[model samples]
Target: MRRSQRKQEEPDLGVLAGRTLFGLQRELFTRLGEVGHPDVRPRHGAVLAYLDEEGSRATDLAAQSGQHKQVIGTLVDELVELGYVRRQPDPADRRAKLIVPTDKGLDHMAKSDAILAGMEAEHARAVGEEAYAEFKRVFRLVADRHSGR
Candidate 1:
């Protein structure tokens, strides 16, 4: 059949991925706001999602998030201004600064973890646990391909 004559029954992979990511982020941020971290946004996920409980270097966050160091720095700055994180000297490396979560950030992190778990559980329930597990496995493989993992 010619392209114009063919029916578009389903979205392509890129569309599906974009839709999924946007939907997930929308739900996450909305939930976060309800829990009092209204300043958290999807763009901050690059730093927030990869942050460690102790602390993390901006460079490390950049590598983990697949963002540039400068971008990570900017996000850290924003988070700092939002009172979610602070820059402190790394105990292991005096020359480097670590992005440490404030008390508010810690609370936000804990809430975020619970919310994401609940979301995943809901998805698993909808799709069946085994199918959801398989879906995650496949998605991870596809996503990690770009990271050379």
Candidate 2:
């Protein structure tokens, strides 16, 4: 087979998938900024997504995000300064503080969900609903198996 045909037959899906996901993430961040969250950084996403409804401590955020406590603490501080999160006395630990999302943060989370839904709908339209469903299923399977879930 010709080199061009061989390349077409076995495209690098890893690169393509990564580019697609990150491209969407970039767009989401841009949209967030356009909607008045100019301070929200891409690095803050892991903490925000994993934050519990009640609240979480820096250590907990670190555990959930697979980051160091100091890194999570720094991100939490940034969130606090941005008015997205507030630190309150931790009921579990008197010396530590719990980070809770403010009303603005909750609104941003809701908007983020809507943005994701819109992107998924676009993917479905492009590849057909059934293909999109299969794609999601495959990704979930890979993630679950990879994570030993």
lDDT of each: 0.93, 0.84
How many collisions per candidate? 0, 0
Query: Which candidate has the top score in lDDT?
Result: 1
Off by over 4 Å in 2: 1-14, 93-96
Candidate 1: worst-modelled 10 consecutive residues by lDDT: 2-11
Instruction: Give the number of the best model, judged by TM-score.
Output: 1
Candidate 1: tens digits of C-alpha lDDT, residues 15-118: 77898999999999999999899988999999989999899999999999999999999999999999999999999999999999999889999999999999
lDDT of 2 by residue, 26-63 (tens): 99989888887777888998788788778888887887
TM-score of each: 0.93, 0.81
